[model samples]
Target chain A: MLASSSTRPRRVAGFLAKSAPAVISVGLLLVTWELYANHSGIKPTILPAPSRVLEQAILNRGALIDNAIPTIRATLLGFACSLSAAFVFSVLVDFFQPLRRALFPVFIVSQTLPLVAIAPLVVLWFGFGLAPKILLVALVTFFPMLVALVQGYEATEAEIGQMLRAMGAGRWRVFVLARLPSALPYFFAGLRISITYAVVGAIFAEYAGAAKGLGIYMLNAKNNFRPDLVLAAVAVSAVLTLVLFGLTVLLQRIAMPWERVGREPSGKGRRG
Target chain B: MSRLELRHVRKAFGGLDVLADISLSVGAGEFVSILGPSGAGKSTLFQLLTGAEHGAGEMFFDGAPLDDHGRHFAFMPQRDALMPWRRIIDNTTLGLEVQGVGRKAARARVAPLFAEFGLVGFERHFPAQLSGGMRQRAALLRTVVQERDMLLLDEPFGALDALTRAALQRWLEQMWRHHRWTALLITHDVREALYLSDRIYVLSARPARIVREIKVPLPRPRDPTAAAAPLASALEAEILDILLNPQPFKGHDDD
Candidate 1:
């Protein structure tokens, strides 16, 4: 009981340690921006204070959500496309050695061709429709997922697989049972990265061609010198990215619940 | 009355010869162990027995050619080597899943054995969630689920702490008595060898050959304590002889 009581303070301290720094950093940035906007003598339109951004958000919520829908749809669609294709393709590359030999260098080379420069061409081919934007997000998101998954699958415990084989497990069954689950952590890792890429890809494709979206809104607002609205769109984009990334984290927690048993809390480490 | 036989088994990795001219046989329900120091090719022999990698030799399981390892035996590695992604129950049922048994049927088979192995209430936990002995138990359960009468075990208790290792060895002794399965175990622990094995084969250093075979005169269901006294002394003395001064011997010698 004494030991348990003693640990409570330390446990509380540990929890605070991990989370405090990020919260503090974001808090400090908001405080600094608010101070700078109020006292730096900049016009409100050029650099809207945090308060002004909030007011603008309240005023333009409907328009923002309206413009957000198409891009969100494109992002989700592209994410799903990339996920399925990556899953199938990665399995192909892993299972067949000759195919891996033939295709891996080509994949690397494809990634090397700049996505930013490539976005306009995709927009041109698919036309200012949602298809190009979805393609762009898929293109951006596929690599990490593929790489993570393949590496994870390949890293299945060699000894255990042999043991399974001795039990008469065929190659396919061995892979499905052992390789697939082992690759999940890597899949989530890729998903976390690809989630960010999915948002950025959708925005970039939207920037290239779109009837409505935060990207188009920001561009038009910038042209009209509505920097306040542009920044507001940027903020919305950031929040959206965070939400997608957070979903990956939450999924990870669910998929790998065994990892949580002895986890140290992230509460107090960032206090300094 | 299934028996396993090895005839002139030879194995090499590229240019390095790991084992040469090995021959052995185990009758049905026999418990035999290969005892050697580290890197003495005991593990390589186990791997060859399980058809992990092909070696130049004839291996017969139950008088049938063991062309493929999956046919007549089960293998447990030096480590628990459980899949970290799978739950304990799922991991134990891997053999059946590999053999095309449906998950439901496999779980049905595994459910009864969990209580026998002291693995109740923890079926849903992953490999990383289990302790060392528990992991070892899980691996054994997986082997048991295969229901193969012949087992190839390579240092099954090598990684466990001493207390756990002793406990597990006794548990293994009990299980072997209850199951009456044929097991070919490889171990560096002399005490483990004498405690569990009916007959123990000692191998020479690198490029291992059968140096000597010691038969334990102890009775079946031998308690750890009974085996611990004379068996431990004999093992220590023989181990020192194998290491320091192994006088050249071509065949089995009791003196």
Candidate 2:
């Protein structure tokens, strides 16, 4: 018990040591921005001081949070839809060779179309509501996940597949027992890449047209010459991305404890 | 009764014949080793047995013709082939799971054998966390857990270090002695063939046919050391001669 308790602080120390560089760099960037804004004496409409931005953020927290709800809702709903759709699409592509040959090229072509170019069209079709924002988020997040899942499925060790088949595992069983589990790490990697885009995609959708959201709020703030409020919304977006990324990392930790344990030094000498 | 029989079996990849008129058998509860040089269709033989490759001729198990090659025998490939994502116990139970056994029941059944297989305390560990030997043991356990009539082992210890290989060989012999599962091992190691097999079949180069078959008269748990067993040395030398200088065909005329 004593040993276990002692190791907890040591683990915390290790974590801090590992994270110190990133924290320090971000702190320095914030300090530089604050110093520059304070000394330049620019008009607040054009370039607000960091303190002014913080003060505006505190004063308008209620309005900002109300707008944030719809944005968060759209992101989560869209992400969930993309996750399931990507899984199904990846499985189909993996199972059917002709479909892969036909649809994979189309998927690549779709990705080449810029989200900015497509967002307005989606909003025009789906209207200025949650539907358009969710559609845009799903479009932006689907492809990376599908590609990663396909790569993961293909990367399953051939020998293991053969072994499973010899043991009487059918095609679906082989996929579930071997392919699906192997694809998880890649799936999570794709999730991490695509999740950061989800909020931004929702915001772009909202910028095109929306009843209320952080994107519309920012547009109103910009038109009213409240640069501080616009910047505050941007900060909230960054925090949202960080929180989602942290959640993905946490999910990975819970789902794959083996990967973490494998990397630790076991201290046991090699056994013959 | 013979557990397995390959009667005049033949296989060809397109026009390139890999196994020409290969015939062999393993009696019930016996250990047989097939020794061959690389590219001698040793793996092809396993592919045929596992229904991965189609071949012409009869394959019988326990006096009945095998309608399907896959269901009758469990197979271990050259590599450990344990799923990296699964815990050791889960990986070992994969065969049973695929055979329609419930996961909990399969785990319950396999849990007791971990100690016997030298995999104690690793039931919850991943494949990457174990050493090479442990992975192979877990793989072997996976193969055996299916409770099939026979096992097809394709150089299961080929990738291990020399010490680990020897140790696993002893462990395998002990397991086989206890369970008496009919097993066919494919290897090019002459000493390994002599030490573990009740009989050995040596195959020639490409378009492999059984060039020689030697029955081991040595007793159980045969000593592998050169000083302890003269008969093993003699058998090893005989098998080595056959492998080095394969005799030309005597009766068959087709080249």
The DockQ values of the predictions, listed in order, are 0.37, 0.58
For candidate 1 chain A, which ten residues in a row score worst on lDDT? A263-272
Candidate 1 deviation (Cα RMSD): 4.8
For candidate 2, the docking band is medium
lDDT of 2 by residue, A110-145 (tens): 888887789889988989978988888888888899
Per residue, candidate 1 scores C-alpha lDDT tens digits across B70-150 of 767888988888876678998898888877789999999999999989899889876666678888999999987888768
In candidate 1, which residue ranges exceed 4 Å CA deviation?
A: A1-18, A261-272, B226-228, B244-255
Q: Which parts of model 2 have CA positions greater than 4 angstroms off?
A: A1-4, A269-272, B226-228, B245-255
Tens digit per residue, CA lDDT, model 1, A37-108: 999999987888988887887788898899888879999999999999899988998888798778778778
Local distance difference test, each candidate? 0.83, 0.88
Instruction: Report the CA-based lDDT of candidate 2 relative to the real structure.
Output: 0.88
| lDDT (C-alpha) at residue A170 in model 2 | 82
